[model samples]
Target: MRSLFGDLRGKIVGKNIKIVFPEGIDERVVRAAARLKFEGLVEPIILGEPAAVRNLLSSFGFADPGITIINPEDYPEYEEMKQKFVELRKGKATLEDADRLLHDVNYFGVMLVQLGLADGMVSGAIHSTAETVRPALQIIKTKPGISRTSGVFLMSRENTHERYIFADCAINIDPSAKELAEIAVNTAETARIFEFDPKVAMLSFSTMGSASAPQVEKVQEATKLAKEMAPDLALDGEMQFDAAFDEITAKIKAPFSPVSGQANIFIFPDLQSGNIGYKIAQRLGMFDAIGPVLQGLNKPVNDLSRGCSADDVYKLAIITAAQAVQE
Candidate 1:
């Protein structure tokens, strides 16, 4: 995990990237922002009442943290931001609506990113996934040629430092074949960002027709669509976990598969399996799961688990800045 973040830090340290934290009053967020500022990693823009945020920092022994804090209620550009929000929302939001919505920190922080005052945004330590994502979807939206955003975890082992990508874990309940294919392609791009060769495995309960079911068929179709979408990508599908990861099982079950036995990116069929799979890897396999990193956004905006610690915030902020640099 140290090596992984070291690589990301190398990319972002001198970039002068600014990342917004909406839940600036949260201890974890404040601590992480202070660390980022101290390390010269990224400029941390925290959203809260100025006096309140400074008081919170002083309580933590950082009397002069030097981090930027903006209160939406009294911002000098509040009226201009409202106009921009009205423009971004088209006819869906009037100035009256923007006046109400932009006061919410999540929406306000997202506006900061949308208006290019900040490079990215990270929240959800205190907000739900919906609260963090809904504004992004409505404002930042996805990149061109992508329909919806997905989340992935960069799972790494401790001693060996083996890393892998697990996808669709934090969003999308029951994706269609098209959406699954999109996840596979997007996850492959994310793997490359992390310097992986990106041999992708579309996971399923069946391997080379060993079983038959609707779920298995979905994997099969998704694999085909993914291949068509990225013919250059090293991807194969409808394979069981063992077949994808173990050379011996690959030889027996999928001898001709391009990604068999060497796949580093695993695209799960749905949210249930993706969520459960990463957790099992984290607990029993002892892997360091470093996300549910939101991908396919036009600009980067990541979500933090409510239970996350200060270290988690710091790492995700680095990752978010790295994504901004990549974009």
Candidate 2:
């Protein structure tokens, strides 16, 4: 099997990034960062204790000049950074409170990005999703024009060049109609990154009022909201998977719809369906599902599945790196 990173590497080489490992000096983090450096894909910075970080890398059989180390305790402006962080959290943080927050891995990662020490960040091997995201929202924040953040995945088949996108699977359990629309718009933008124009299908159990339920209504409202927010997008919804991907079903069920028969992006109604649906496609359909790629942050930050292989970390690093803009 061709490694997923082998494909994405070309898309994001020479990009500089700082990857925060809260787990501190783990072999997977060291080895993957070393691979990123060896491949010239990124400038990898490891944030942890210098001695332990160096020892771990050496033990992992990685020796790369591109690797740099920093310890939060020894960081020149540790106190100043902590002070600024407290100031940024004026309403919610005290000096002691800021000290406690700095002790957290995710907040420290955000502090690194805020200080211009990194173009982007990726953490959360040992942390919960909420722990990782709260820091991003309160510290790194959303980019201009991005109101909310969501999750996306890129599903690619082996024998064919076909790639599909799915969204909000790893975040947003039961997003409101407007939030669902934002998820659709963001997922569409992410699809564009991988060169898909994205004929989006907002999925539901019902197909064009075939069933009357609150769940179906939610999808219908989201579809209308998406059309209003992104007028030029090729999108339609309250559709079934069959109607979205099958020509015959689309012809019979939604003949007038431009997106029904050809959906490059699938937006699920809720986390349960989205997560279950993507896994079914990956396992049964034999496709590589390439992310819980977090979107809508001021600076790009991502989470690893913890069950992730080293190459998985490497590839997401590239994707996250590519999202960064030089300052």
Candidate 3:
């Protein structure tokens, strides 16, 4: 984990990437922001009342923390931000509506990213996933080719140093074949960003055509779409977990498939499997899961688990900045 962060830090150092923390008053967020700024990893723009944030910093033993703090009520550029929000909404919101929404820390922090005042934003330590993602979808929105965003975890084992990408675990309850394709392709890009050469496997209960069912067919179709979308990507599908991961099992099950025995990116059939799979890896396999990192956004905006600690915030902020550097 330390080596992983060291690599990420090397990528963003001296890049002057700016990241926003909406829950600036949260102890975890503040501590992480302070560490980020102190290390020169990224410029952290924290949203909160100046006095309150300053007091928190002091309590955290950061008497002279120089991090930027923005209070929505007293921000001088509120009008400008509101105008831009209205323009971005394109009549979905009025000035009055913008005024109400932009006062919330999440909305205000997202506006900073949308307006290019900040490179990215990270929240959800104290906010729900919806509260953090809603503003981003409304303001920053998805990239051109992507219809919706997806989340992925970069699962790494400390002892073995084995890493893999697990996708759509944080969003999309029941995606269609097209959505699953999008998730797979986007997850592949994320794998590359994290220094993995992606060999993607579209997971299913059945291996190849060993079984026939609606769920198996969905995985098959998604594999086809993903291949068409990224012809260069090394992707194969409709394989069981063992077939994807074990060399002997893969040789018996899917010997001819490109990703059969060496797949580093796994696209689950649905959110349930994706969520459960990563947790099983984290708990039983003892792999350290590093995200739910939201991908396919116009700019980076990530959500943290409510139970995340200061160190988790610190690492996620580094990952977010690394994404911005890639952008």
Candidate 4:
């Protein structure tokens, strides 16, 4: 883990990256911010009252955090940010609506990224995933040609060379064929960041035509579309987990695919499957699940589990900072 983050810091340090933490009142978020500052990982700008943040850090015995605290009620550029939010919404929001929404730290923090005052943002310690994601979807928006944002978890084994990516695990509940294709392409780009030569498998219960069902057809169509989108990418399937993982089974069931028997990236057919699959690998496989890293947004904004420890906040923030550098 030290080596993993050391490599990340080597790439991102001195780039002067700034990461915004919107859940300023959450102790885990604040503790992580303090550690990030102490380590000089990135400049952390926490959203809260200056005094409140100072006092909170003091209570944690971190009296000299040297981090920036921006109070929404007192930010000098509130008017500019509020108006910018309205314009970004393109009539979905009036100035009055923007005024109210920007007061919420998630909205304010996302605006800092939107305005390029911050490189990226991380939240969701105490907020729902939607609470943090809605602002990025509306404000930062997805990258051009990406219809929606997705998430990927980096599954790395300790003391081994094994690392894999699991996608669509935290966003896009029931993606269509087109949406699934987009997730595959986006996940591929993410894999490159971690230096993985992605061999994506579009996972499903059926392996090729071994079974026929509407859900199976969806994975098949998604696989076809993903291939069209990235013709050079090594991916295939509508395959079962066994066919994708076990060499013997892959040869028997899906011998023709370049991805069969050796897939490092797994794109789940839906959020339910994606969510469940990653958790199983994390808890049972004992892999270090380093993220539910948000991707496909124009700027990076990651979500932390509400039950996250300070270490979780610390690591995800590093990952978010790295994402900003990649952008």
Every candidate's lDDT: 0.92, 0.81, 0.92, 0.90
TM-score of model 4 vs. true structure: 0.96
Candidate 3 per-residue lDDT, tens place, 114-213, comes to: 9889999999999888888899899999999899999999899978979899998898989999999999999999877778899999999999999999
Instruction: Quantify how close model 2 is to the true structure by its C-alpha RMSD in Å.
Output: 2.1
Per-model TM values vs. the true structure? 0.98, 0.93, 0.98, 0.96
Candidate 1 structure, TM-score to reference: 0.98
Better of 3 and 4 by lDDT: 3
Question: Model 1, 158-252: lDDT tens per residue?
Answer: 59989999999999999999999999999999887788999999999999778999999999999999999999999998899999999998999
Q: Which stretches in model 1 have alpha-carbon errors above 4 Å?
A: none
| Model 1 C-alpha lDDT versus the unseen true structure | 0.92
* Candidate 2 residue spans exceeding 4 A from truth: 1-8, 17-22, 325-327
Rank the models by lDDT, top first.
1, 3, 4, 2
lDDT of 4 by residue, 1-327 (tens): 667777888878777789999988888899899988888788999998788889889998899878989998989889988888888999899999999999899999999999999999999999999999999999999998989999899888867857889999998999999899999989999988777788999999999889999999999999999999999999898899888888998999999978889999999999999999989988989988876799999999999888789988998998899899888
- Clashing pairs in model 4, backbone N/Cα/C closer than 3 A: none
The predictions' CA RMSDs to the true structure, in order, are 1.0, 2.1, 0.9, 1.3
Q: On residues 114-223, what C-alpha lDDT tens digit does candidate 2 reach at each position?
A: 77888777766667778888888898877787777898888888688678888888889999999999899888887766667889999999999999999999999999
